[model samples]
Target: MVRIKRWLLAALVMSAGVSGFMLTKGTSHAATTDPQTFISTLKSPVTTVANQYKLYPSVMMAQAALESAWGTSTLTTTANNYFGIKGSYNGASVTMKTAEYDSNGQLYYTNANFRKYPSAKASMTDNAKLLRNGTSYNTSIYSGTWRENAATYADAANALTGTYATAPTYGSSLISIIKQYGLNTLLDASASDSSSSNSNSGSTPKPKPVVYSKATYYGASGTQTARLSGQYATYRLYNHVKGTRANITKTAWSKVAAGKNVLVYLDMRGVKKDASTGKKTTWYRIRFAKNTSAKKYWVYTKALTLPTVKYTSGTAAVKVNNTVSGSYYDHVFNSPYLAKSMGALNKLTAKSYVADKQAIKTQDGYKSTWYRIKVGKQAYWIAATETAAAPQYDAVTYSAASGTKKLSAKYSKYTLYNHVKKTHFNQKTYKWPAGSKKGTKVTVNFKGVKTAYKTTWYRIQFNGSQTNYWVDARALA
Candidate 1:
């Protein structure tokens, strides 16, 4: 049985305003006949006011459109009051007939005094101040401190509908208008422009895209329906989050071939333990191609190779070695107290690259460190302890200048530690081969320093031997 989560109920309630206002019937004005023209003319002023108030311009424009009827209302044309702000401003006022709903939901017609602004810009600015600071007519809906609350456009619209408007659908109506015209895109574009301007002015650059691990699933490719059995044998596909399972029948299953790409939608849910292996692993809800009947599924986190870095726009370029060990996700949870297991790492490809590293706090309050790596375009996380810095020796050209240092004279002999291969810095010490003897007359091939260990190791080739070995400088005389 899959569990469903209720995360969107609060947003629905806030969108459905309980009370609403009715617009008074009036003749349209010829000066602002086109809705598009009216909206375009006011966009600049509306955005200015919204930015000053930390409110969404889309919400403000929608409210103005509703209250002024696209600038055709007599009150808007004559008094430049697009927001129906009622009060004396600079001692200028206009008496207008409007409809209001009483406490018992009864509609009543009444003549009220409205503020007269010098221009539409002034009217829009004053409207923002009214909502942000509040007046004798209503308390501040956004916040007592200016521009501190109302983090989103929907939040500002909801607050106005709940406290500033008398109509039940006022908030939803504003949202509809904003969405119908795709006004949020303009808001986003404006923000991007601001970020660019800030960068040109020598300010701190905008945040770069955070790199994460990319994962893949290796399952058989075919359309075979198989019922999941056993305790925790069933992999539930969630609509979103942990508890919201998809409505599709549990008996339906589609398997893809090993190394097939699965696009990951969300990775922040933390780790789940694999019941069969008793291994702590992270699960990714992945999206498959349209051709696949099962468009989405949850797979074991270990079946994919995580990259070392995920690059984002505005991030500084970092040079990284492309080689990594096969062991991934051994103890990479955001918590350290959890027991470590190699089952997850054993499922991934033998080698990958490290893209980035970060310290994270897991749900259980353990400080687990992780590394961000990429396998193709996808990102995944792995335990920091499982990987070591492997520099590309093939990319480095060996020359006399690079190997000027000779073997130390303190000791005359050195034992071979594994077959001569590329030296690894900052890694665990290699064990000496059994029955190996130390010799003093080895020819030094290269002298290099491992930055991670802060030590020097000599790459040496013994007389008439094709193999080379890396011996610590401390071990040679």
Candidate 2:
């Protein structure tokens, strides 16, 4: 009888070992298989949760990735708590001490309650259920892509404050993740977020034409012609890059076909090149008065395919007018560049001199106003309304000179209609160095308003120049 009992015990032990080995193998396979499998499995459940809450799947995925470490976290494995959710879960709970830091930079330890469940799937379902009922987890106002990278999702899983702080590069990181992992593909209708398929026909407005108000020509050699006409005539602007157009939209630039020239508008905005691929895009999004939605059109330089226009000092020119009409020959400005003395150009700093307002497509919009000028330079079509009389200056000297001593401070601020320069002061603050001879003529030229401040306090940028700051009229002695 004793021998029989020993044999039965050995058989039971062998069975236990085999079961352990099988469990380990199964776990290893589940961990190593494509993460997308897990993503797919959770899609339906995630979609159900999002639809009930009207949340974006991208946002939900971000939150999940941040809390659960893509289902690999210790909390998920041990407790089946994907969200690190703190609270009592029926009678099944765990009490633990965790460190926390306050905004004032003080750290303290606190014991809190955590929920324990049977599996990750169960944890996820319960988390959704709790979020639906919990007043604190109110998912209504909480929605946005987490990070641009998959690894960031892991870090985000640990975030206690539903949202990661507004750290620099948050948007870029999330966007990069979406692009790399094709997470946006999960946004398809069949995926977790059904709203992706909802068609709101009335909400979308009709597409509008992109208006270009000005154009300039770069000669082979060198000569800047300030254009007077043909700002929006659609003659041609060259593409800065070569690639297949992917996200091109109206006014948005796209790659031109190989060996073919593309004419794009020179909408004035800084261009951006993709960090990974060299594809380029424009920045202008100004809109016209008629079509309010026209503002959505963004102009870029990379969409066009043409001989690149080399803008040299003398070759770069501009023109301003009432409106952008049909395609016509560019009547380029031939007059010499204008220059202004300190007395004329000094105060012209407050106003913004736009080189091209045509990119905005607004009716009667003007191109950038001239802020740089040289003396004795003459240009045609100088808008009479835009020009301001040269500032009158009263000379100041230590010794009695034959000139008037009254300062120009009392006169109304004057501005230049065209680009002007200062042959004198460099810094915004110019004064007589101590112990110098009194005959040194110190004249303060009146540049126009610094900025357009409305209330009792005034803070203005230079209207025609680059200087923008606070200037006290009383301090202008």
> lDDT for model 1, on a 0 to 1 scale?
0.49
Q: Where does candidate 2 have its weakest 10-residue lDDT segment?
A: 1-10
What tens digits encode model 1's per-residue C-alpha lDDT throughout 376-436? 5655445444344222321222333133334455433544443222332222234443333
Clashes of 1: 27
Candidate 1 deviant stretches above 4 angstroms: 1-33, 101-105, 136-140, 144-148, 199-477
Residue 147, candidate 1: how far off, in angstroms?
A: 6.7
**TM-score of each prediction:** 0.35, 0.29
What tens digits encode model 2's per-residue C-alpha lDDT throughout 112-152?
Answer: 56676655455555655543343453332112212221123
CA error at residue 50 for candidate 2, angstroms:
2.3
